[model samples]
Target: MSSTPTDARLMDGSGLARRLVEETAARAADLTRRTGTPPCLATVLVGEDPASVTYVRMKRARCEKAGIRSRHVELPATTTTAEVVATLEGLSNDPEVHGILLQHPVGPGIDERAAFEAIAPEKDVDGVTFSSFATMSFGLPGFVSCTPGGIMRLLDAYGVDPAGKRAVVVGRSAILGKPAGMMLLARNATVTYCHSHTADLSAAVREADILVAAVGRPRFIKGEDIKPGAVVVDAGYNPGNVGDVDFDTAVTRAGLITPVPGGVGPMTIAVLLAQTVDAAERQLA
Candidate 1:
């Protein structure tokens, strides 16, 4: 059957992110009004990867627009892992900083996990810390990884009930893939994770009612592997802004699909701002 436009809905992450950011800005203003302090996010970057620099700058710009304060800490390319961790720890201890974001791919030598763990759990608004992961896995009250949290928000906004659904998350990165599966599991979805080591990846993907492609390879998940009418969330942001799922073919098969540039990207920053506000509110209380 030839699929009509109504056969698949384009999940508008940009639109939803705009609404979320607006709400977050209002909350940030209200919090500042009540506490005499604006919610602050401290962004730490190790080494100057051009893409990481641009991403951090964008996040700070969003923070400014949302009425949140941003503190930037830039380290040299020669900085050691311990130095990076120490810098993050200092920011974590700063009372004025309600959120901490350590831009990923801090060069090749740095121990990324150790640095991520340096951020205090309460201020881990980017949700990279072990404590934050545990909390998110348990469905506890804690900040979640921005991308995964944003994905969940998109799901909710579109009225995609995950309860009893079979969800396949393609990738196992701590921040994006693993957390995404955990979030879906929390919502009562039977979740399966597929990574580079997973055998028969296509077989797993074919079983999913909901599929999240976060493997970071452009057009890695083919349309033939997608279950018809599946909810497809493409969270990959590779060079040229291409997504993991082959969008042109997958769109015809999916019941709903998120576009590459207009989809998961915007929601990530929106979730960060919202969580920063939430952290600030909790700290004030």
Candidate 2:
């Protein structure tokens, strides 16, 4: 029933994320002052997928910038799932390590779920464990999946309350899509989850007052399908820095839309660093 009055306003995710990181930095400094131990985050990477290496490097850099400490463990591509689990379990038992992040898609053969479960729920700063999901789903106090947590923060920053909106999440990945829908639902949005198999995807998309596209495909959510005046969040980051929602077309129809590079991407790291600090403080306390 509603329509956009003009071209969609771009959501300033990078700006918001910068502010968030600054706040987290302050908290990190406080923790350091109080405990003589700077918040430490342990990042585990399997193999040297060029992309994963770059990501870990970036994360370490961010942790340093935020006044948090970083420890990295690199495992070979040939390492078995059992080895990965043992490594994670070791980190979990280490008192000095407050937060643990196991880089995703560990490799072709490793059992990612088993590796994730090896992390103690208290140190699950990456929010990969089942305990994290259960807590996130119920709006309880616990760590959240970073990307989804960032999405909620973005929504809050933009003053887009989800209390009565119709939210459609177009993906079902365990870390991103599923958690995102649960987040919106917890905020009282009427939530629908659509994936690669959804029938009449366009119809479902058009009905959304809030649209979250996390399908990791480049421009999969077309402009024509966007509902006018709807708030659009494109969480996809495929090659070429493209998002699931087509910015070119969707911008004209949406009231608010997130650009691929400066939008959800920056927020993801911001939330991760913030959560790392959170875990550290809790453990230190």
lDDT of 2 by residue, 131-164 (tens): 9999999889999999999999999988999999
Q: What's the C-alpha lDDT at position 187 in model 1?
A: 93
Candidate 2 ranges with C-alpha deviation above 4 Å: 1-6
Model 1 alpha-carbon drift over 4 Å, by segment: 1-6
lDDT of 1: 0.93
Estimate every model's Cα lDDT from 0 to 1: 0.93, 0.93
Q: Please, what is the TM-score per model?
A: 0.97, 0.97
Error at 136, model 2, angstroms: 0.8
Model 2 TM-score on a 0 to 1 scale? 0.97
> Looking at model 1, how many pairs of residues clash?
0
